[model samples]
Target: MINEIQHTAETKMQKSLDVLRDNLAKVRTGRAHTGLLDQVEVEYYGSMVSVSQVASITLLDARTIGVKPFESKMAAVIEKAIRNSNLGLNPAAMGDLIRVPMPMLTEERRKDLIKVVRGEVEDGRVVVRNVRRDANNDLKRLLKDKEISEDEARRGEEGIQKLTDKYIAEIDKMLATKEADLMAI
Candidate 1:
């Protein structure tokens, strides 16, 4: 029972870390990458689909992303989708290709982005802490039911704490790297 609780908590923590990573990726720096448009959705034949499904995304340069839809007619829709995705990007339709340029981050915008990243990191920490709390509670309940000894419960709690610390450290490292990326010219 103790092992199950610990394993479940660890899995939940790992998933939270993965979500945090995805969120951080969405917060773009000055550099451009195809992943930046991963969340963009476009209307396709009366249904909405991701930009990648209807078009191909590639990095034209360090600061520009090139998206070319399979059908030339879809280019306008893809450009509109990217513009409205609220990533603060401007995609111009140049014939069959849509060029999305990542604007340079100003000092103020960089500071704002850091604040946003810090908020995301804090949310990640909260999720990990919540998992730890729930696992500890499960251990206590097991102890109360006489299924686990007090010593065993204590050990399980320690193990859970170690997992929490490890995940939190990884989250912090991601934040530090993102901050450096944002600050770099």
Candidate 2:
């Protein structure tokens, strides 16, 4: 029972870290990244689909992304989807491919992106702490139910705290690195 609780807690904490990593990937750093459009959905026929599902996205240059639609007819739809995305990229339709040029970030825009990243980091920290709280509660419940002794529950709680600390530290490091990336010219 004790081992089960520890394993569950570790799993939850690891998931929180994964969430942080995914969030960080979505944040742009003034570079051309196909991942930036990973969340964009384009209207395909009568259904909405991920842009990547219908098109191949590639980095044509340091500041340009080339999106080639599998179906030539979907070129306009893909361009519109990228234009409408919050990424602020303008797509130019060039035959079967749409070229998206990444714009230079203004000082104000860079600061705004940093603020957004900071907010995401705080949310990730909260998720880690919430996992710790849940695991601690579960440990206490186990002790009360006579499944685990007080000493075992205490040790489990300590282990969960350590996991929480490690994940939170990882988030902090990611935030710092992202901030630097965003601020760089």
> Highest TM-score, which number?
1
Q: What is the lDDT of residue 125 in candidate 1?
A: 100
Query: Which candidate tops lDDT?
Result: 1
Give stretches of model 2 more than 4 Å off: none
Global CA lDDT computed for model 2: 0.89
Considering only N, C-alpha and C atoms within 3 Å, which residue pairs clash in candidate 1? none
Over all chains combined, what TM-score does candidate 2 have?
0.94
Q: Write the per-residue lDDT of candidate 2 for residues 31-110, one digit (tens) a residue.
A: 99899899999888799899999999999998899999999999998998889998888999988989999999999999
- Model 1 per-residue lDDT at 160: 100
Q: What is the per-residue lDDT of model 1 for residues 1-185, given as tens digits with 9 covering 90 to 100?
A: 88899999999999999999999998989999899988999888899889999999999999999999999999988888899998999999999999999988899999999999999999999999999999999999999999999999999999999999999999999999999999999
TM-score per model over all chains: 0.96, 0.94
lDDT agreement with native, every candidate: 0.95, 0.89
